[model samples]
Target: MSEPRWLTDEEQHVWREFSVATRMLQAHLEGQLQHESNMPHTYYEVLVALSEAPEHRLRMSELADARKSSRSRLSHAVSRLEANGWVRRESCPTDKRGAWAVLTAEGFAAIKAAAPGHVEAVRESLFGPLTAEQVVALGEISTAIREGLSPRCAAAAAAAEAESACAGEVPEESFGVA
Candidate 1:
């Protein structure tokens, strides 16, 4: 095989900028959430996803995939939220072996309390710094990346589900890995 082509200087700079921006943006958002809402961004995402899920519930495996987290991590997180009266897990009635994570009314309230601050933080840290055209460009770029990645992600998710079902367990590495 031939050696991989190196990035050009401009490409390298752009890539570095994107990485830094993403890290900084996450840090900023996390800080905002912690300071204003007493919650972590990841936990908030789980609550939000559950709130939006059908019947305010989703399969544990599916929730892990949606959050790009491992089952263990999600389990731990859900436990924490359950302690806070924000979430609860129930066994799937249709499948005795399956479980579903459900957002409790308290969880819905917490997310509702957190949403305004989160949106304002996002706006302040991101859109406030961008021009309208730049915002549109960012959206286009994000859509392009998602469009390219979604099929691969979906295929991997399906494969994981099938494999787990066949084996009667999720792989140790079944956690979503970016």
Candidate 2:
């Protein structure tokens, strides 16, 4: 095998900056949503996905894909939203295993009430400090990152021991190697 290519100082700096910036942004957004909307950022994302779907409904699988989430996790989130009367589940007639997640009128109202503050929070946290050109650059960078980690690349990464699902403080024995 060829020798491993290690990151230079500049590359390491750039990586750290990008990683910390994303984490900080998510933390800020999460705190804002939890405080103002009484929902976590993940739940808000689900509601937004459902609200944008045709007739405010999507197949459970589609919802999971939209959220980039697994079926079991999405099911748990749906259950929570259903309990809050923000969403309802209906079995699909064509596919017994398939179901639809439907946003209710109350859910629509809840989202509408939540949107203004959420948008403002996003603006303050993300767009407020950036120049117009920087905002454009941010969009390009985000899209590139998303495409780079698409399923094809993800599979290759996993086979290479890339540990895509790990967070900080995980044990090497319990989790995969670094």
Candidate achieving the largest lDDT = 1
| Model 2 Cα lDDT, one tens digit per residue, 51-111 | 9999999887678778877556678888888899999988778766567889999889888
Models 1 onward score TM values of 0.84, 0.84
Clashes of each: 0, 0
- Reference-based TM-score, model 1: 0.84
List candidate 1 stretches off by more than 4 Å: 151-178
User: In candidate 1, what are the lDDT values of residues 81-151, reduced to their tens digit?
Assistant: 98899988787677766777889999999999999999999999999999999999999999999899989
- What is candidate 2's local distance difference test score? 0.80
